[model samples]
Target: MYDFNFHKPATLDAALETFESSDDGQFMAGGQTMIPVMKQRLAMPSDVIDLGAIDDLNGISAGNGLVSIGAMTPHAAVAASGTVQDAIPALAELAGRIGDPHVRNRGTIGGSIANSDPAADYPAAVLGLKAIVRTNRREVAADDFFTDLFETALDEGELIIAVDFPIADAAAYEKFENPASRFALVGVMVCRTGSDVRVAVTGAGPCAFRVTEMEQALAANFNPEALKGISIGADDLNSDIHASAEYRAHLVGVMAGRAVGRMA
Candidate 1:
């Protein structure tokens, strides 16, 4: 890894102040993506500010028709929380299915979403549930937060505080994951609340996005059969050695169907 100064601030204000003072600073949350990149000399920030010591950025609460997860809370905490399990079983299930035990214990939801990896699981859930991402400065709707591959709407030095997910009437997620990495080759999240339906897809595109046709069809008839002829074109999707864009496009429908079926 490149030589860099490290700071573990106990409070958000201190963290922000440190970042502002550095010539080039990067926040480290769980260090899942950041550390690996640094080791490869892919990233060389002047300073690394760790968010782990901030007490305010850790916790999970469920109530008032919402599941509020603190930014620094690990994946294992979300997967094991009785509150998450009861309030949104699909969400808990999704968290449980993330990369193995070590990654789960070390990876933070804030880092996952903030990194905005196209194949990451949390972005699908966030977009599917239409959750609100709360940063130190402002609240961003999930629809507007993810911009593109490994990118987000966050401003420079902005810190995500928490994510608030509304409890949907019904929800489910299905993913065709790469066996080795457990990263989604193709993943879909289906959520229905009242008369609204949302179908979000990950892994196939530059970023997690909604399938308007599937959403419209499901809103009219929430069933697998309703998605009969629905399919997204492969022109805009990712094509890697793991899976072709055409295959990912096909899996999008299959996964969406399976997710909707699971919600039944």
Candidate 2:
């Protein structure tokens, strides 16, 4: 890593102040992606503001038919939380399956959402579940939160406070993971709340996106067979060494089918 000033602010206000004071300052959440980028000299921030000491950014609560997860809450905590498991077992399962034990223990939900990795699992869940992202300044719906690959609606010096996920009638997440990184090659989240059916797919495109056709089919008939003839176009999908765009598109259908099957 290049030389930089590191500041561990004990309060959120202090962190925000430090972040705003410098144009080249960046927030350090779990240091998962940011650290790697720094080591590769991809980012050379003048100041690194560590949010680890901010006590207000860690907690999990369930009430009013909604589950609120703090930005700083670790994936392991989210996976193991009684409230999360009781309210949304599939979400908990998804969290549990993220990366390895160490990654789960260190990576934060806010970090994941902010990074907005094209193949990240949480984006699918957020979009499918219709969760609201709470930031220091405002609340952004899941649809508006993600902009594009490695990008979000978050502005400079703005920090995510928490995420509010409303409980759904039935939901599940299924992903075809890369063996090495455990990142999804194609992940799908299916949610049925009342009469509304939402289908979100990740790892198959530039960003997590809703499958309107699949959602319409599921709304009519919530069954794995509903996705039998449906196929995703491969033109916009990520094509890497591990998998081709066509393969990822194929997995989108397969994973969506599995998710619907699991829900059923």
Candidate 3:
């Protein structure tokens, strides 16, 4: 962890201005990922522009069968939001299951997805539900937002303003978690949002991905039974000390079935 200049601008313009002025500046959203990385000396930015004080970055609104959440809105706020619970209980449950209470209290949706942690919960929800990622300059579709491991489609200076999630006809998330850390060993989010069925998987690959075959099966018949005998080859999936690629590949099917079962 290196010493760095800290800036908490009250406006988006001010934050962007401060961020652009520095050669090595980074945005601090909730500081959940940045703080830990800083402590471990993994990141040494010259300036840290805090987005917390920007009022526009901290609220939740729901309308027209879609729920919009501010970038800086905390995970706890999202989990406890009455509007969220009613509009998308599965999303609320997913938010509640993120890390522990402290992490949820401080970690944010924007920060989580921006970091693009391969095993993160929000990416599944974002992609599975086909959300719109509104940024300072443009809107990115969820399908295009996650580009690779720890990567996104956002430009270096772009800041996410908010995310718009379209309500689904049915949705559920299931994860085989590492008990100690609670990070997903393999997580799956199953959703049928109108005519399309989407199955987004996380923790078993470099980044969360969709299984279109399963999506098609589930789309044809919205039931866990529809997923029977389907498989995802392990060639590109993750193989780690926690779980082997084969095991992870297996868990993907199991979790997807469980997710669909909940919604079935």
Candidate 4:
């Protein structure tokens, strides 16, 4: 990795102050993606502000019909949390399936959602569960948080504090993972809360997106058969060596069906 000043701030105020002072500063939360890119010279920030030391940004809380996950909370913690398993088992399952043990232990929820990797798993859960992303300044609904590829609604230097996921009445996640990397080639999350039904897909598009057609169909009948004829177009999806756009679109339907089946 290129030479850069590193700061491990113990408080949010200190982290913000250090970021403000640097010409170009990048926040490090678990360093799963950040470190890999930096070593390859993809991201060479003047300063690396490690957020791990900030105690307030880590932990998991569940109550009041919501599960609040601190930004720095690692995937492994979410996977192993008894509270998460009891409240939202599907979410726990999704977290457990992300990468291998090393990635799970090192990747943070905030960093994953902040980086917004098109194939990342958390985005699917965030969008499908209608979660609220609480940042340092304000709360952003899931629909408005993810803008595009590797992009978010977060303002520059605005840190994500936590993500609040409302407990879904029923939910499940299924993904066609790339065997080597374990990244979703096509992942789908289906959830129903009260009368609202949502279907969010990742790994197939530029970013995680809701499938309104599937949602509408599933809302009418919350079953695998409800999605019999529903399909998403491939025009805007990613077409990589791992999978073609059309194949991913096909897997979207298959995965969505599987997820609904799991819920049933």
lDDT, each prediction: 0.95, 0.93, 0.92, 0.94
The segments of candidate 3 whose C-alpha lies over 4 angstroms from its true place after superposition are none
Listed per model in order, the count of residue pairs whose N, CA or C atoms clash below 3 Å is 0, 0, 1, 0
Error of 2 at 135 (Å): 0.3
In model 2, state the lDDT of residue 119. Answer: 87
Residue 143 local lDDT, model 3: 95
Query: Compared with the true structure, what per-residue lDDT tens digits does model 2 show for residues 102-210?
Result: 9999999999999999989999999999999999999999999889999999998889999999999999999999888789989999999987999999898888999
Compute the lDDT of residue 182 as modeled in candidate 2.
87
* Candidate 3: residue 246 Cα off by (Å): 0.8
Kindly report which residue pairs in candidate 2 clash with one another: none
Error of 4 at 184 (Å): 0.4
TM-score of 3: 0.98
Give the root-mean-square deviation of each candidate in angstroms: 0.7, 0.8, 1.0, 0.8
Which of the two, 1 or 2, has more lDDT?
1
| Model 4 lDDT at residue 112 | 97
Q: After superposition, how far is residue 65 of candidate 1 from its true place, in Å?
A: 1.3
Determine which window of 10 residues in candidate 3 has minimal summed lDDT: 1-10
Q: Candidate 3's residue-wise lDDT over 161-233, tens digit each?
A: 9999999998999999988877898999998877789999989888889999999998889888898989999
